[model samples]
Target: ISSLRDRITTLNSRPALDPIRIGLFGSSGAGKSTVLNTILGKHFFLPVSGMHTCTSCQVHVSVCKSRYYEAKIFLLSHEEWKEEVKNLLMLVESRHKNDETDNDLEHAIKALKAIYGEGAEEKSYEDLMKTVPEVTIPPSRVITLKKTEAQDLASELDPYIRNQDGVVNSSPQREQMQLWPLIKQVQVTLPPSDLVPEGVIFVDIPGTGDANKKRDEMWKESILQCTSIWIVADVERAIGARAHEIMVQEAINACQVGKCSDITFVVTKMDKIEVEEYVRNHQGAMGNITQHTAILETKRDLKIRKTRALKEKMMLRLPSDAEVLQKQDMVFTVSAKEYWNFTVLTREETEIPKLRDHIRKLYLDMKRNQLHDYLQEILGVFSLVQAYHSTQLSQDPPMRQEELQSCLSGKIEALKAVTTLCFSQMDGLLLKGVQSARNTHKRNIEKILM
Candidate 1:
């Protein structure tokens, strides 16, 4: 019984961040997906470039001993589904009345029409509210895919991720199934590799450009659970006002003030930045170089200048009151496309490999911390138990009935105090979480409604 009790205590003391969560957040076209692809060494999560994709969160976990790829989908709740349908109906009505075109709204209508037939698009607000059945989304789902069938499966899953029926022949179908909006989250499990650390989950959050209220709330909630965060941004535009606000103003708050160590700022698409003008303007002795040398010299100079500029810009923009900003590493500039394609020789200044190394180190540190915590808990538990056992064993003729009763009473009182304290702490934490979630939901509603 004592052994069983010890095992139970060990299980109870397990750390929450066992599978360390690394969250990725950025605006659309910021190369977040590209960074994700580079990290994974494969294009597992599809990137919806130049467009806002679905707001559903995508979680990628590495599955060991699984030879094939797999996915588990979590759909939105019934209330969320109804809210989406009503919003689409309202959007269509408003757009039609004003003779204004909204591709997103129209795309939604078409997807619904495909799923529920022609009446889906033509239904009035009241009719939709009455006719639409309450959707019962499963708590969890699992899908398996052979290596060869992964791409085909991704195509099938595109509508769910994109929140719209994919384009057909460069034109979207008027009546095609779109399941993306109905999904609250997706879990993609791939075979374990160097890119995916064991017992780590990578989260890809949709850009803030998405207008969905429910999705926005989910995004905020996910941030609270993350152990680390990566803020991906376009290299040229990363220091701009909007990106700065997101990184310095909002993301800092979302990651929790004291708990998080630092936020990693990843400036992506470095290859896209034109350096010809900078090269010509400040070439100095490096001028009159050959085409190859000029390109290399130009890239080198631009990288040094941009890196310094971005660092200075971030230092200026970061809140003086927030000490977390000072702990972060200097900005990392990378071209995921160039790295993936191996078109250009990767330089240390780009820092893609360095980022990977840092992630590995972070994982090791987290595991070491977890092990230390587990050891401390086990040691404390065993020490108390051993001391209690020794006291009982050393008792002369066992204690008298009155003495025993007094000892039992003291122990009971101590246990009661500990239990009460635990419950009180739990209650306070829970209440704070509830309040935070409520505030987040309220803000999302106001943003959407406005």
Candidate 2:
């Protein structure tokens, strides 16, 4: 009776609610941060450094009830920090040996100096290894600030979150610097009105193609946790061979074998393309083609061509499961910079709102599905409890035992039937979805191959 009551208590308790996560994944400097900033309508909070800025995965969320900004940073273990220090020192030494004209190399040296002091350049590899902490502490720490206005909050969070200029040498900045190199994760919660929903998380992950193995594992973990994934890129580089390879290697390859859902492709930096120049170069005549007219016509032509090219490239790369790729309205062109600038030409043209809507709907759908599954499990538990109760109420012991055994067998058979039926339905649905994706892929491939 106690065990049965405990089982009932377990069934009645609410299950843990995991937040919906969306992952923005792509190559370094691929305008991924821009896409996220645009989505959140926040500026400069997420560091938009050109080269390997995001070294670890950062998950951003919003707390509707809280008025202040909060950041929970998860630092790496001492061993991990030592490894990161080794990598940074090696890069700095290599830069010192290599070309003196490279600005990136200069930035790397300055960043290293900013963290390790002036002598950082002269430190031997073994000396740098010894510089790491002798003891290991808990891998995470939290920092909270009284909530300020959106713009102000964004500015304040910059030092704590930004990659390029985040590290400083002040006495109080020691902990921040020590943790920055080994930061495995950063969780930031904004105010209620921020673009981040109360129960949904947006993860900003470093590119998987980097040399850091720990961070690469974090990137893979982020992908596994995400409910939706967006592969962001600059419009000029969207369908490039490297872009295709990354998408296939990081996303499509997973979808081919795993329970992968839809993946969206976002082409950012649309404003960078000079429509008039493209029109002049590609079209037969550019004379008398008014700027606005040329811009409209060129954008239309470019979208059409890019879409075709993207489909062809993806199909070629994912020949076996091309259609699954096509099922998603995967291509989105955006100009996050222009959207924030609010210029006449760029104002209503930004598709950030459309993407936002898609995410909102996806979140709702996920909630509904979760609720359905939960209710199904609850019903099963209730039915089992009901059978146990019915058996307990019977007065005739021997007859009741036989009756209970029969009842148990019937219940087991019924449960098996339900399980088989559910599996069959799911299999049918999965097959149908795959077939639809394949059909879409085939149609797009036909258009391109012909």
Top-scoring candidate (lDDT):
2
Q: 436 in model 2: Cα distance from truth in Å?
A: 48
Pairs that collide in candidate 1 are: none
- Residue runs of model 1 more than 4 Å from their true location after superposition: 1-17, 43-45, 51-63, 83-115, 119-153, 163-166, 169-177, 211-218, 255-259, 280-330, 347-350, 394-450
lDDT of each prediction vs. the true structure? 0.62, 0.64
State every prediction's TM-score relative to the real structure.
Answer: 0.68, 0.67
lDDT of 1 by residue, 124-188 (tens): 76676666443323544333334535576566555556544355523352221244445556777
RMSD of each: 16.3, 12.7
Report the poorest 10 consecutive residues by lDDT, candidate 1: 169-178
Question: With candidate 2 superimposed using the best TM-score fit, by how many Å does residue 148's alpha carbon deviate from the native?
Answer: 2.2
RMSD of 1: 16.3
